[model samples]
Target: MGALELLPPDTAAVLREAAARTAGVTGLVVNIAVGYGGRREIADAVKQLLRAEADKGKSIEEIIESLDVDQIADHLYTKGQPDPDLVIRTSGEQRIGGFLLWQSIHSEFYFCEAYWPDFRRVDFLRALRAYSERNRRYGT
Candidate 1:
């Protein structure tokens, strides 16, 4: 969530806050998960894995063959946090928009016609209710 493919317009302040927040902070954690492309995130994970293995003196073939889901997940920024249970895509858009691509592989998606500003508590409750009704396989 901290790492990004691109930053939104004028995000210096948010970045500063993110830097200051430590594990001891008890307030709401606001992560700016932006400018991220799903494919790019996967590639970045692979790159990190390669670098780590190389640093430990792994051969190229060994690194490639040893790659696994856990290694890539550790490299991902959202590794420690639980993957989202539901994604609310507002403003009438039904697309996934590439948000949390790898992390949200099994999340329930809720598309709303209202914009973020207009998305109220009722909308959120509705999303939760709908998710409760579905039988998720959790990727089996």
Candidate 2:
């Protein structure tokens, strides 16, 4: 029910419309990334954090001394959501390509040979099974 992206004006308008339409139908929430990149996301979050703290009458030194991960997390686009447990990489890609960089610190990844268009339900099942078999250490 949310999106993470540096959206174009038109796209932002469309997203707003969609969100308004889906306001209260809340069994499952889906997040889609359009023009999204992790480094940019972090940069945006930092800008937002600075503005918010400044608005609260906090000086730069005060903000710096009190700054923590939670403050940054609060400004991230995916503010209220849990980090992903599994990320199935399609199209035979073996790297994360900076997807959800800050949030995916403890996620499990599955690389599939098929491209997104060619991916099927069985492949999804295989990815799920692979994830289920792993002993997630969450960085111990």
Candidate 3:
């Protein structure tokens, strides 16, 4: 009866419901892509884009013109969610490993040495505090 065992069904239900409920929003979204693969996400996005275009009777050229990074992002599961203010990776992982690769373009990142299982509220607060103190220049 651990977290994993208690997760799948509720997670699936919530995600399905979110997708259904937000079918018309077509704006910001927040996808909690736990256990998600970056490459697979991109592939799925492309496939979905193709299907949507086919459904709309749009030509490939027209679709391509509309399928820039912003459009692709809009089509993502987490379309409307604000890009993260800060992405904190615990346990000192140096590599991003493709988590939120597109959304985090301008995000501030913090790496910590505490393992996730051992993470504490204070650790999170520290990360937030650090983020709050930084002068974020979005590629100025």
Candidate 4:
């Protein structure tokens, strides 16, 4: 169970160096959002927007009208990554828990009774097969 928090300051730089040395990849955007809470992330984005408007001597209404999902997504750590096509939460947890809320607007979800460590490749394949068989009209 290797955690992302073990690295020190400038860990991104160190990781980039290590990746370059080992895998020959120089540019990478690693989002180590451990202990990341989605509600907090949204709150942080709002605070950032407020600070920006205050710095420019603007009003709250002006900022509110300009704010949209795209702006929020741009401010998010997972900005560039595509919204997951399917989100699988094992152990039968029937909640989104705010994971990629904006991005997962139309994403499919699959839940299983198996625990995280107990999940198998066959279970993953079954989820994919189920997704493939569904008529994903995206709420048409």
- The better-scoring model by lDDT among 2 and 4 is 2
lDDT leaderboard ranking? 2, 1, 3, 4
Off by over 4 Å in 2: 1-30
| lDDT (10s digit) by residue, model 3, range 1-140 | 12233467977677678768887886544444466766666677778878888799999988887777776776665566788878878778987778777778898998888987698999988998999999999968
Candidate 1 ranges with C-alpha deviation above 4 Å: 1-32
Native-referenced Cα lDDT, model 4: 0.70
Total clashing pairs in model 4: 0
Per-candidate total of colliding backbone pairs: 0, 1, 7, 0
- What lDDT is obtained when candidate 2 is compared to the true structure? 0.86
For residue 86, give model 3's deviation from the true position in Å: 0.6
lDDT of 1 by residue, 1-140 (tens): 34432565357566666666665776444344456677888888889888989999999999878878989999886767777777778889989887778888898888888887688999878888988998998888
Give candidates' CA RMSD values in order. Answer: 3.6, 3.9, 5.8, 5.5
TM-score per prediction, in order, is 0.76, 0.80, 0.74, 0.68
Clashing pairs in 1: none
List lDDT for all candidates, in order: 0.77, 0.86, 0.75, 0.70
lDDT of 2 by residue, 1-140 (tens): 23424666787788888988998876655555666789999999999999999999999999999999999989988898888888878889899887888998999999999987698999989998999999999999
Candidate 4 residues 3-66, lDDT tens each? 3455565765676576567664444332334456678767777677678777988788887888
- Screening candidate 4 with a backbone cut-off below 3 angstroms (N, C-alpha, C), the clashing residue pairs are none
